[model samples]
Target: MSLRDRLTEDLKLAMKARDQLRMDVIRMIKAAVLNKEVEVKKDLDDAEMSRIMTTMIKQRKESVEQYEKGNRVELAAKERQEISIIEAYLPRALSQDQLAEIVDSVVRETQAASLKEMGTVMKAVMAKLAGAPVDGKLVSDLVRARLQ
Candidate 1:
C-alpha cells in the first residue's frame, strides 16, 4: 500500500485505540502535507511527502535540542515521542558505511575529483538517494572526506 493510504489507516487505528500521541503526530503530518498542497496548488507525490516527513523530523530534533538546553525535560521527551511516531512512516535510514560507499560511487560516477566539484557531487548523490530517507549532512561529510 502507498504511504498515504497506510498513514490514513494508522490514523484511524490510533483514533480507535485512543492513542492520543500517535493520533496527534499523524494529524500534524496531514496538516503539513495539506499546507504544502495549498502552497503548490496540487497534491504531493510520495517523494514530496517523504521530504516533508524528513523536514518535520529535522525540526523536531532541533526542538528537542533547544528544549534540553533550556532544561525542559518534559517537552524534550514529548518531542522525542513525536519523532518516534513520525519515523514509523519514513524509510529506514542508511548506515554510515552504506552512505559512504554511495558517496564514493557517486564521486567516481560523476568524475568529481576534488572539493571544487562538490556541487556536482552533491546533486548526483541526492539524485541517487531519490526518496530514501538518508541524512544530507552525513552524505555531504562522507563526500567531502572521500574527495579530500
Candidate 2:
C-alpha cells in the first residue's frame, strides 16, 4: 500500500484506540502532506512523503535540543515522542557503519580527493541513499573525515 493509504489506516486505528499522541502526530503529517500538495499542485509520491516526514523529524530534533538547552525537559520529551511516532512510517535508518561504508564507496566513485570536492561527494552520497532514512550531518561529517 502507498504511504498515504497506510497513514489513513493508522489514523483510523489511532482514533479507535483513543491514542491521542498518535492521532495528533498523524493529523500533523497529513496536514503537512496536504500543504505540500497544494504548494506543488500535485500529489506527492512515497519518496516525497518520506522526505516530508524526514524533514519533520529533523525539525522536532532541533526543537528537542532547544528545549533541553532552555531547561524545558518536559517539552523536549514531548518533541522526542513526536519524533519516534514520525519515524515509525519511515524506512529503517542506516547504521553508522553502513553510512560510513556508503560514503567511502561514493568517495571512491567520485574520486573526491579533497575537501574542495565535498559538495560533489555529498550530492552523490545523498543520491545513492535517496528514499532511505539518513542523517545528513552524519554523512557530511563522515565524508569530511574520509576525504581528509
Off by over 4 Å in 2: none
Per-residue CA lDDT of candidate 1, range 1-148, in tens? 8888988999999999999999999999999999999999998988899999999999999999999999999999999999999888998988898888888888889888889999899999999898988779888888889989
Candidate 1: segments with Cα more than 4 A from true spot:
none
Report the number of backbone clashes for model 1: 0
Best candidate according to lDDT: 2
User: What is the per-residue lDDT of model 2 for residues 12-112, given as tens digits with 9 covering 90 to 100?
Assistant: 99999999999999999999999999999999999999999999999999999999999999999999999999999999999999999999999889998
Model 1 per-residue lDDT at 105:
88
Using alpha carbons, what is the TM-score of model 1?
0.96
Q: Model 2: how far is 46 from its true place, Å?
A: 0.9
Residue 93 CA error for candidate 2 (Å)? 0.6
Name the lDDT value of residue 40 in candidate 2: 100
> lDDT for model 2, on a 0 to 1 scale?
0.96
Q: How far is each candidate from the true structure, as Cα RMSD in Å?
A: 0.9, 0.9
